[model samples]
Target: MRDAYHEELDALTDRLVEMTRLVRSAISRATTALLDSDLQLAESVISHDEEVDRIFAEIEASIFDLMARQQPVAVDLRTIVVALRMGTDLERMGDLAEHVAKVARLRHPDSAIPPEIRSTILEMGQIAERLITKTGSCIASRDVESALELEADDDAMDRLHRRLFKILMADDWKYGVEPAIDVTLIGRYYERYADHAVRVAQDVVYLVTGSRTQDADLR
Candidate 1:
């Protein structure tokens, strides 16, 4: 019975890691769709987002069932609870990716970002991808070092966000109001995506260190 229970826990971990990979793909594809205005790819990202949501629901239900049946304690309880939080964050990240894809779809044939700030937005997308990759690594290996490094990784995204705003607020800005709003919303989507990845990595840190007090920015 104990062996079976442990196996179930391992399966739960696998599900969480899989969700990370799916969301990572979503954001990466969404970024490409945004840059190129690829309607097909944008639709694909939007459609497959349901996979992440389904997994999140599964992880939540499994955690609930495990708690009710096994009464997990100490590290076991911590891992289960953290899995729940991580799944939630990952699902939210997926939704952000979907939102980006929707923006691309809405503006079909025209890129969401203007030429001036395209590079910055591209960099933001790249940083978001890197952070989420490390998030998956932390989940798979329980690498507390990589998990801790995510805070600094997130700072890079923050910097890119500021650069985006500077471009928008420039004295000679000529992109017009609709483009400005699109870029603003795009920048925010990428920033929030990175924030969710950081939250997942922070949860990994909490899982390893057994301290939730360190993460004050989980939102």
Candidate 2:
């Protein structure tokens, strides 16, 4: 019975890690679709989001069943709690990626990003991919140090986010209002996606160290 119970707990970790992988791919493809204005890729990202949602739902059900039947304690209890939090954040990250894909679909053949801001948006996407990739490593390895490094990558995303606004607000800006709004929303989606990845990493830190970082505390 003990062996079976522990196996269930291990399964929760496996599910969470799987979620990380799905969301990571979602964001990567969404970024490419946004940059290239590929409607097919954007639709793919949007449609595949249901798979990430399904995995998170399973994680929640398993956590509840474990709590009710096994009455997990100590580290096992932490695993359940942290897994719940991580799953929630990963699900949100998937939604954010879908949102980015929707923006690309809305613009169709014309890229949502302007020529002036395209490179910045590209960098933000790259940073987002890097952050989530590291986030997956943290989830699988339970490496607090690697998890903590996600913050710096998130900082880079934020910088690019602010740069987007600066470009939109510049005197030479001539893309007009609709394009500006699209860029703003797209920047926000990337920024929020990175934020959620940071939250997942912070949860990893809490899972291992039992102490929340200052940013995690704010969450």
Best candidate (score: lDDT): 1
- Model 1 RMSD in Å is 1.8
Residue 135's lDDT within candidate 1 is 95
Candidate 1 residue runs with Cα over 4 Å from true position: 213-219
| Global local distance difference test of model 1 | 0.90
Clashing pairs in 2: none
List, residue by residue over 1-219, the lDDT tens digit for candidate 1.
569899999999899999989999999999999999999999999999989999999999999999999999989998998899899999999999999999999999978778898798789889989999999999999898888788887888999999888989999899789999999998999999999999888888888888877676443
Candidate 1 accuracy as TM-score: 0.95
Each candidate: what lDDT?
Answer: 0.90, 0.89
For residues 117-147, could you state the per-residue lDDT of candidate 2 as single tens digits? Answer: 8789889888988988898889889998888
Candidate 1 colliding pairs: none
